[model samples]
Target chain A: MTIVAKFEIPYLRFLDSEGKINKPLPHFAKNSRDLISLYRTMVLTRTFDAKAINLQRTGKLGTYPSSLGQEAISTAIGAAMQPNDVFCPAYREYAAQLQRGVTMAEILAYWSGDERGNQFAANPEDLPIYVPLATQCLHAAGIASAFKLRNQPRVVIVVCGDGATSRGDFYEAINLAGVWQLPIVFVVNNNQWAISVPRTAQTNAATLAQKAIAGGFAGEQVDGNDVIAVKYALDNAIAKARAGSGPSLIEAITYRLCDHTTADDAKRYWDPQTVEQAWQEEPIKRLRQYLIKNKHWDETQEAHLQVECNQQIEQAVTEYMNLPPAKLTDMFDYLYASLPAIYLEQRREVEI
Target chain B: MSEITLVEAVNQALAYEMQADDNVVLLGEDIAKNGGVFRSTVGLLERFGPQRVLDTPLAESMIAGVSIGMAMQGLKPVAEFQFMGFMYAGMEHIISHASRIRNRTRGRLTCPLVFRTPYGAGIHAPEHHSESTEALFAHIPGLRVVIPSSPVRAYGLLLAAIRDPDPVIFLEPTRIYRLVKQTVPDNGQALPLDKCFVLREGSDITLVTWGNMVYETLKAAGQLAEQNIQAEVIDVATIKPLDMQTILASVEKTGRCVIIHEAARTCGVGAEIAAQLAERCLLCLMAPVKRVTGYDTIVPYAKMEKHYLPTAEKIIKAVEDVLSYEG
Candidate 1:
């Protein structure tokens, strides 16, 4: 038989689950300051996740999706992206949003069903949270196409969940990106579950990363629990995109250690044993152990950071709580550039 | 002054806008080298180059979502679905993102994109290729549904659609794309959207229609005029954020209305207009508001299509029934 072609998916891992270096550390690992910053953000994200769950349980907030074991993926994304680059995020990407300068109060307001949360002044041009699974992949491809058209140096990083990779929108987007050689980086968080359905049912593909090959781009995998590995992969992808080399797909393998959302009861379908197993490789603890093993962080520093995270989160919660509710007319004001007669008449009926 | 068919007029509008605005771009399947399946985008890629006129892969949802992204980032992208029947694949993006982005972002980000596709049944086309589903887009809150009947209106309204601050669904009448030619001035002028164009004035009855139905309604009005029963013709250019003021004023004058459209009758745009007129101008209406539209069934294949569309004769009969009604 004549050989036509062959392909191999690259895998990346800098640290083992126990915090020991399994491979040569990437450049980001050599910078203790950057590593410490990533650790701090991951800690802060976890702290926020716990408080958010409490808020939901106490009826103070709406159902919130936690970033439990996947903190490293979002942290690496946020830390590695340039300010000018656009971040297209899925709903579960609260950690990434926070890293990109979105305030905790803003996220809280959004989960509470307030439109004001999407008005991000810090990341003015960034796309707001996408709720419909893989649709943002196309939006990112479009944004990247615009950058290419204008000859801009900026790149777009669009993140989606493992299940989103099964959607036609994801394939269509990556196909177009490949055809146009658009400046985009697609990061799929393969967290092993899509609500009640497991990853095995979503696709029979060997690795989610390999799906990029069908769309004519390079695909690679990374240990999502290892922030250094994610950062390394994301940095290289973004750099390649900005340099106009074309788009790349990075699948960050992780595990969902919590229920899909506050509204879900994973205990109904998930085996408790698997959940217990996933907790062993959780990202926050892995990074913390690494920091402690390197002597860059001690028990005293960890305790201080915890107290600080609590104070900051409490302040944000208080600020969000004290704000006045949005007005009804606010709905009519933004529906169009100018209010038409139909809306005016409707508004008048409501005024009385 | 130049005489051009409606399809040529569409090409003119796209070419003119691409020249006038650096941000205006065209993207669709076979639009670049093939100049589109209908040649509505002929000479665009040659004039604007591949950068401005992109030939995308055969994916409708991506075409729509990408346009939204481009529009958000200060580019005016005009995306084309090969036909309206093929638009259902893109309906998710159109309904979810295109229509709600402006309101969702509180005016911080607006989608200034135009989704163009040819609609209506005629010319012996296949089943899905001939669909008049403008009402679907018109029903969307944040979208402006614009349809043009003649060459002149096609050129003018298309420019306005691309220039609109929000998303607009520009549905072209496939039947009349090359059926007739009119002297359309090449001047880069756009007609006002969200306004009804009164084609022929009469105080007897208002014949409200848009897209290809406008042609039949005009023909029916002429036949009605010969019978000494003058019928007014009003082309509703913009279906959503409908120009009800103009329609209501005409109905108030004529005291009768006969809406015509080649879309499914149930929950169609004609139903909305009829309901609105009944609510606001009930006392002024001399007779019941009537609708001459396509059946509630799926548009039939080529052999059965002509029997499915709304015709001038059908429109005239409805006007006669409303005019002669005692109730």
Candidate 2:
């Protein structure tokens, strides 16, 4: 047997850095509703994130992690996923969750420190936010393994940050997926920073995609700020995985314009000029510019989009705040099928 | 009735369960081709192929975390941790996820997973090879701990553990894996998880123990019998959801109790048993409960392991002290 050339980083670009589409973009839908939906979701996500940070400042929500500049990656990847497919996300994928099916109220409730936010919806399609970093990668592999064993034609998508690639679970899960030929697509949102540590301090590898080669898997690096590029990369990866070809890794190279979370201040560790330069490549702005240049959007439509996004966000916040306070017993309810004796005792104490 | 060692009995139970249910899968290091380090998973790979009997990397956390996901997806996974001492690496998954998945999912998911490991001292193996950490699991909610002392009990309890709807930690004593032999029934009926079995019944004293120490307690009881001291031996198989009624009844009848375990004395299962007996059966006790357990020190290498574990002599001494008490 002979080894083949390393997998080329797959990509499909519609817009260049100067905010110009290479050619006339195809219209998949007859009425341009699809494009309008995508734009609306992006604006809604940005509005929700800003509201979350404001809530955190007002002591309404707990520490919030704002996905300010990474909306394109989440929106595009989430759009490519089928409703039946399982999505395992890290803490910063609130936009992805909302687009997949989670309501804005539910997202706000989670950041407000309520257990109900993590509860499975009536028709559960995704798992709760896994907080232990790359551990979710292993779960995604297992889910995909189950699908393969049962001969199910569903793909499992796992979303992680660049910092998670350094964890042991990431390597173990990817290696297992490769060996078993399980149907899994790993998306790494390389935002260039892990808390206070920058990407340079995380690993010497020039690109996170190259790390996948060590595990005998195919990989690609896409411009995460480009919505169309992210959607095309994920769509092809998902298609390959569903075809029984094994796992693939996509590293979305983006930047976090905001602090890590409300609790962190990035200015202390990162150069202020770097932050200023990254803001120019914001994902939402880049996509909006592409739409305007293609004659698909104008200032009148932009004004209408802002008004629509604000109204939707205000309604969601009103509904979320009006809901009853969270029950303390919810903490112990989902821990087991039968309540263990210790938790029973704790519940009794809480009642007292 | 064919007699077989504890390891053979465990292997037979796995073979029977896999044949009975297609959802049962075994995954661990060397369990597929090499038949495991102690050969507890021998012949499983040949019978179940690579999909059912997966050979995984040496990462314990991955093995356990993936099992949790598999179990959530409606598969019964039996994971092996080469040795009980190495379970520390996977403790977070076991404690945080496996034990809480059923409740965390609000019954939307159940982790019917079994973690099988060889535990206890007397193997004379290197450091970190023999450890008895059942107490730590017993303290956690939503998990069941099963410790079978004989071949027949191990087979029946293991079957029960696999079929149970919750996560079960099956601790097999490596010291007695090859030493004990009995006729295990071929039929797949499992013994209950939280019930105790009386190995030898006597009204003079109640000796409660499980795992390898059960044999030692029985030997001590036999030696006491020679001295006109009749002692009852009860094997408390499941540590969590303990059989308190059976124990309280035995203590009430015998008027004295002695607990034995191979784990360290501090915060061990023996303490919990003693405390429960004190709270429930205090008035009936003729003397304070006595405990024979290992010291609170790291399990040393083979050279000094004999001094680190509890022996028959220690159980007999504890029995004598309890019998000689005037209060």
Candidate 3:
């Protein structure tokens, strides 16, 4: 048996980190509508993140994780996916959820700790928010396995963080996905930090993408701050997955420019210089500058998009805040088709 | 009726359910080609093919987690965890997600799945081979916990669990897999998922138990019969629903009670049964309720297993204690 000493990370990107496309741009759409749409969604998600933090500070919402600087990755992946394909997102995938049809009001309600906000009716292709870390990878693999078994032509993309790669579920999921050659893509958002612990402390490996090589699959590393690069790489990987080739891991090297969640303070851990460096490479600004420089966007259009996004986000927040208070027993109702005796007794006690 | 061992009965149940419903599928480690470690799924691969009888990897969480997704997609999946003790690895999926899917989705989705594994002590197996953890599943709100005492009950309860429109954990007693034989009904017959059965009737004291412990309880009841202490025996086929009416009625009629189980004593099924009796039938009690349970500790390996299990003698001692009490 030949022991492999090393493997290479395969990244296919048309755009560099400086917003320059190395290859000629494809003749898809020059109307700038798509670019404007990406900008609007990113701004909306950012606003949502800020509002969620404010709500938590005022005791109006539960602990919330913000996707502050990772907007380009989520927006680009959402843009490249087909409607029939399924999206299994981690808790920090607010932009992806919004782009894939989850209402802002519903997402806010979920962050507010209401079960009704977890509703997944409109987007049948989207899974509920997976909060248990890397467990969603296994779910995505299962869905992809089912689709393969039934001879269906759909890809299942699962999103996870760098911390999730160290979890056993991540390995089990990818291993199964490889064994069965399922149509799935595992996206690892390497935000560099998992709460107070840094990514370097979590794994000794050089890159999270290389972990996929152990399962006999290739992976790529991309600049997560560039929307163009993210879209190009994801589109190729997703196409390869849908063609029945198997699974691929995409490690997007991004930064968590904000705290891990609203309940945390990054100032307690990271130095101010590191945080400042991350803010300089912010995904939204990089994409916005590219659009303006290419004459695809102007100051008038940017101002118009900002006003529209702000109005939409405010409306969603108002709708969420006006909803009725959640009931405690609502937790007991949907566990099974019929409640067991123990839950019934507990419900009765609560009623009394 | 055909007489068969508990292992054969479980195999027959899977075969019959697979034949009756096209939606029913089985998946687990070595469940297809190897026919399961206990041969509980023998001859299923030839009949159902690879799609229906899948041999999964040795990952427990994926086994249970994938079953939840399959059930959500309108398939009835019966997954085997090989042994009850290994079920702990998949407890997150069982207790948190599978049990809460229906409630979490507000009836929009239902996990019609069944997890089957052998539990209880009596066999001289290695460490982690024998465990009685029905109470853990019983304490969860959305799950149904079933423990059948005999081959016939095993067949009937397995069918009921497969047909039930919810998730159920079917605990099969491995110690008695081939030790006892009973005449089981033919295909399509099923016992109610939430009902209890009265094995014997008497008036002196009520003996409540389930699973393999039911045999020991019956033996103790027989020993009491010779001493003129007529003890009533009730087998709790369904542990979660508890069939409180049957237990409460028996406790009220006898005015004395003894709960038996092979799990740890601290928070076993016996504790829940005794507590329910105290809260519901305290006025009718002539003596305080007694309990016969295994000591609170990890199940020791083969040589000392008998000491760790609650036996007939232990039940007899608890009965004597309750009989001699003046309270």
Candidate 4:
């Protein structure tokens, strides 16, 4: 038989794990302010994650997913998109939400079991964090279809975990995006473990990014711990999408440096040696090291930034705790455009 | 006004809505070029062109999910499933995302789309083609389950489902898609949702039903009227926010009730109406509520379908049983 088709998967990396330059840097790297800003956002995410886990442990918050080692993936996607573009996030995309104008107090309030926490005043087009794995991919495709139908220049960005690639929703979503040639970018945070199921057991597709090739799109992999590499790949993909280049998938290789959530104990399944090795390549420390070596940051600035983050987190906690409780009618109020007669009568007994 | 079949009425209503509102679009497998498997969307693609009338892949989950995304973005998408049984593949998107988008976002976003599918056992179709699973969609809190029994009702209700600002499960009865014809005015008018239609009025016994079972109940009511037992017939157009007021008011007058449906007897919509009557209208109920429904088994293949569906004779028997009760 004659040859049918051939495809290749690409990989991208800039700064290595040891703060050494692995390749020539992009134009954005020359701007020290941009790098410093990205670094600051990663630090803010780490601080916010620690406080959220502490609150969960103290019984002040609901179950929370930490962005511990996967900060670069979320932060880069958040910083790459424009304001009119849509952002569809997975459950652990709090870092991206923060960068997209969602308040720290709003995040804290949502984790405290209040629905009002998701009411983002600045970004109404941004979807709330989806808990059901890769379902947001389909929503992203739909949003992209709307933009394409209306002939708009905006793009949509969606993120999911490594395990989400195993679900049928993921394949179905990408299939439609490819067929329609929609303007959306899908990023996979391959942090090695999907809540105790290792990446080895997820699939044998060689690499998750290669899955895009079968759906008729460009697929590439990047070093997720290196923030510079993530930003470069996402910037290129977002630009291509805006120029009507259809969809692209980026598989960011990283590790889960901490437990899956406060409700989980990684020691039960993960090997101690693996965890120790992963800690050395975490995202925040790599970015911090890159900033310090480049003379863009120093010890005094780091100390001052830590103090400010602590004060801001404390203020958010106070505001979240002092807010009035949600009304009981909130359950019935938002269920439909207008309350039907049946619900109106049922709402009487619950009224206080 | 012109005489048209139920399926033709569906096509006209869709065309009218697409012509009136630029945001309304159609998508499903074989819906655009093939005009749908049942010809319910026949002439939509030729009229609206390919941009508004989309023909998606054979992925039911993406079809439902993409419609939700479009609705959230201020577009009114009307998606169709080839058959009701195939809706199982899209149930996760329906129950989790489409039904919960409004409540999940705290009213910041709403899913104003219609998921249309042909259901019930008839026309000698295959195993998966014949199903009456309206109860499943009705069980979802944020969904509105609407079914049309005649041509005019189909036109009016389809228009209303597209205009409503929430997700609606529009289940059309395949058994009666072209069984009869009626004059439906293409005036772009929409009937109020979440209300029941009183098809026939009497005072002896009330026969409450929806979808295909409405035909059987009306036939039984006519038979009862000949035997000096004038029965009241109520067609429950919307199943979810069941206009229990109309059913309750009819029960209050007739003092007896019997519900007929083609779905399974266990946990069917008929059970909900029966339970509600026991709770609110117990004082006026002269006899225990009776249910005439299909068996608690999977809808059988073509040969056994006749035994699986609720017939007019069975509904008449149920009405007679309720009338014979002296307690």
Candidate 5:
């Protein structure tokens, strides 16, 4: 009998939870500039996430998903892509959306139930966040097919949850990308839980990254709490896709420190000891420790950054509250390029 | 100008559009070298090259989603599902994303793609291959549902669907793909959408139908004419954004109407047309408006298909019932 094939999922980690450098630094991390910017953005995201949950608690905002421990994965993908490339993200990718020029106010308007919020003026090419699980994976493959067809260097990076990898849309999407050799990357934020369903129950696979192997592409894992490791994985994958080498999948291991959303309470289904353990390895805290230990940040700078983030978030909240109410006709206007004659009376009858 | 079958006319229309617009591309299972299961996309790959003509994997959701993405990026993709029964796997994308993207994004991004599939029962194929569940798409707000019953209409309407600026669900009636031939010019002309084509004019009754049922309805109209009933035949080309004005005017003159369709009787497109007549032409309708449609059960297998499809005989019976009504 002849042996068929062999595959292995490569893992990477630059900084451990104790602020110790475990792996050699990538080019961007060798200096402090990129690391500082990443830290700043992660802090911004963490601050924003807290404010959003607060608003939901006070009945000022709708149900919101908190990216408590997974900021590094979103921030790393956003920072790694070029302006011309596209990003197709699932819900809870505020860090990436913010870096791609989606304003905090715009994000607020959307969560507050306004369609006008999705029309991004600065990032027109990027897709609006898809709430349906795993659907964006196929859209990213489609967008990448366009880039491949036009002989362009643009790549598409799509983010999904660990549970999404169980859906057929995820497999079908990666299959097309692999077969067509499309310029795209599938990033799975394996945050250990989907709402109430644990990762263990989601799939029996040893690692979520190995799912890409079935599609004939490389797959790997990273310490998602380590911002540098997340950034390094995206950089390598994005470069390969841009050069038309094909697609890759990276399963970033992290944990959802908060409940699934404001509508949920993790205390009901989660273990108290497990939740406390996850907080120690949260992305923002681990990265902040790494920055301080590496001498790139200090107590004085940390104090100033916290003050600035709060001020910025307060300004955005004010702008979001002051923005004009969404017009009643907005629902009818964007429905089609030109409204058909039959809908004229129906459009006229629309009321608030 | 050359006479061709409905399927041949479809092929010609696709070739014309891909030739006229470089942005137009085709994708589906077995669409490239295999031409297509029905040959409607034959010769397109050879002419347009693989860049514009692609054979996608056998995943309906990906085909629908990928085309939406491509359309958002300014490519006009005409994606075909092998069969309408197989199309349900992609219904989530069609309903949740393709139909909602433009409206949700406030026109910043739009999906201007076409989802084409062979629909309706008649050929002695499997049960899934024979369905007229077009009402499912018609119920979607942002999608335009277009069906062509004849060769000439197929050529013109398909071209218009490819050119329409919104997402379109273009269902071709497999029952009539090769049932008839007519001289259809290859001219790059498109018919108007969201309007009904009034095929014949009369005052005794109005016979309204679409898809392969158009043949059965026309036959009923001809038989009604022999009886001096003088039925008006309306070919409702586009089911969504229905042309109720034409049907209203006809019902006003005829004082009676019979709506024909092959989908299930409950909540079918026929029900929509019947309800519209009751709303807009209630006073003009001197008699009653009746619906001649398929049964409420699942579209049956091939051997039992004829009993399920609305026939010219059933349509004639319906017209007679409406004509005899005193209300």
Candidate 6:
């Protein structure tokens, strides 16, 4: 048999597990401020995640998913996208959503089962968190299609998990993106686990990034624990899409360092030793190591930043807890643009 | 006004909407070049150009999900499924995102789209090709499930479905797509949704139906007219947010009712109508409500299609049974 096609997936990592610079720093990393800002946001994300888990444990919040080890990936994505560009994210992108102007209270409100949480007042245009896996991939393609049709220089970025890659939606979306040459980016947070199922069990493909090749676009892997690499890949992909060069896929290979959600028990499926070993390459620790090694950060700065993150999270939590319950009629009021006359009678009987 | 078939009327409505609104777009498999599997979108690709009439890859879920995304951006996307059977692959998107986006976002984001598909089990189609599961969509809160019986209603209702500010499931009856013709004007006047259309007036009994079953029910009404039964026929156009008041008024006048549908007997739209009539019109009724529907089994292939579909004879029988009640 003759080979009709050939392809390769290039891996990228600016800093290794020990925080050693593997190569010369990219332009963004050469400036200490950019890296420091990224570092600050990631730390805030981790702090927020921990506080969310604590709230869930204390019966203050509903089931919540923590992006404990994958802060770099989500934070980098939020930084890469512009304000006008749409973000069609699956659940579990709190870091990105926070960066995109969604308030911590709004995010908390969603997990607490209030309809208003999805309003995204500041970022009203971005998609709300949809629970279904990878279904938003097509939404990204469709949003990109609109931009292309209207000749707007806008990009759409959609994120999903490794398990979502096994779904037809992911494939169909990437395929449509390729066919239309739509302005979109598909980012897979290959966090090595989809709840109890591991990456190996989710697909037989050697790498999730290579899946984009089948869709007639470029795909590559980035060190999700390395914020510089994640941001670099996202910046390139978003720029390409904005320039009308079509779509790209970036597989951010990170590890899920926490349970899938408050309702899930990853310890039942994960090995203690394996979890311990993964901590060595967690995003925040390596970034902190790099900053400290470069003298851009000191013990005094780190201690003050931690206090600020805690104070911000505490204020958001206080605001969220004091919020009033949504009206019972909110469900009916927003069911349509205006309630149909036929449903008005039924709407009146909406009792507890 | 031009006399056109039901499918032709659909094409007219789509063409009119695309010309009137720049945000209106069409997307589906084989829709752009092939003019749709049923030719309901004929000449759209040429008229609107590729930018508006997009021929997407053969993926049902993507068609639906992408439509929601496009709708969120202020574009009205009329996405087509090859058949009602193919809609199962896309229901998660429709039921989850399209139906819930408005409520989930508290009106911040909305899905203003029309999901069109051909339904019902006549004309000798394949197994998965013929499906009439309108109840599943009607049960959802944010959706408006519409099925037109004739060319005029099809044109008016389709125009309305596309213009409505929310998600609408426009299920065209494949059995009657080209079965009959009517003088439908392309004046761009959309028929009112959430209302039933009275096809015939009578005092003896009410024949409530929509889609292909409306044809059979109307035929049954005619047969009853020959027998001096004088049956009233009503097409419940928008099944969800149902125009029950019209049906209730007709039932209150006729004192008897027979609900007919092409979908399965179990948990069908007919069942919902019958239940509502029982609750609202029990005091007005002269007889127990009856339903004439397809059986609760797989929609058979070509050979058994005639046996599976509700016929004029079966509708007449159900009407007679309801009329024979002696309360």
Every candidate's DockQ is 0.84, 0.52, 0.54, 0.84, 0.86, 0.85
- Where model 2 places Cα greater than 4 Å from the true spot, the runs are A1-14, A22-33, A122-125, A325-328, A340-347
TM-score of candidate 6 restricted to chain B?
A: 0.98
Which residue pairs show backbone clashes in model 3?
A: A334-B102, A334-B103, A335-B103
Q: Could you give the DockQ of candidate 1? A: 0.84
Expressed as tens digits, the lDDT of each residue in A1-352 for candidate 5 is 8879999998999988887888788999988989999999999999999999888888888889989899999999889999999999888789999999999998988888888789887888899889889999988888898898889999999999998999999999989989999999999999999999999999989999999899999999999988899999999999999998999999999999988998898888999899889888888777788788878999999999999999999999999889898778878888888988888888788765
Query: How much DockQ does model 6 earn?
Result: 0.85
The interface root-mean-square deviation of each model, in the order shown, is: 0.8, 2.3, 2.0, 0.7, 0.8, 0.8
> Ten consecutive residues with minimal summed lDDT in candidate 1 chain B?
B118-127
Candidate 5 clash pair list: none
Model 6 pairs whose backbones collide: none
Off by over 4 Å in 5: none
DockQ, Cα level, model 2: 0.52
For model 3, the superposed segments whose C-alpha errors exceed 4 Å read A1-6, A26-31, A341-345, A349-352
- What C-alpha lDDT values do all the predictions have? 0.91, 0.85, 0.84, 0.91, 0.91, 0.91
Residues A1-352, candidate 1, lDDT per residue (tens digit)? 9988788999998888888888888877998889999999999998999999999999999989998999999999999899889999987777788988899999999888899889886778888888888999999998998999999999999999999999999999989989899999999999999999999999999999998898888999999999999999999999999999999999999999888999999888898888888888888787778889898999999999999999999999998897698878878888877876766888665553
Off by over 4 Å in 1: none
Expressed as tens digits, the lDDT of each residue in A1-352 for candidate 4 is 9989988888998888787788889999889899888888888889999999999889999988788988888888888889899999987777788888998888888878788888887779889888788988998899999999999999999988899999988998888889899999999999999999999999998999988987899889999988889999999999999999899999999998888887899899999998889888888887788889988899999999999889988988898888899889999999998889898878887799
Instruction: lDDT for model 4, please.
Output: 0.91
CA lDDT, candidate 3, residue B185: 70
The list of candidate 4 runs beyond 4 A from truth reads none
Model 6, runs deviating above 4 Å: none
Tens digit per residue, CA lDDT, model 3, B1-327: 668998998998999999998888898999999999999999999998998898887899888887876776677889999899898988988887788777765666678999999898888877788888788898887888998888888898999999999999999998889978988877679988888899999999999998888889999999999999999999999998778889999888999999888889888888888888888889999999888888899988888989988888999998999989975
lDDT of 2 by residue, B1-327 (tens): 779999999999999999999999999989999999999999999998887999987889888888887887888999999998888888878888788766655566678999999999998898888798899999998889999888888889999999988999999999999997888888997888888898999999999999989888989999999999999999999988788888899999999999999899999999999998998889999999989988899878899999988888998998989999996
Restricted to chain B, the TM-score per model reads 0.99, 0.99, 0.98, 0.99, 0.99, 0.98
DockQ of 5: 0.86
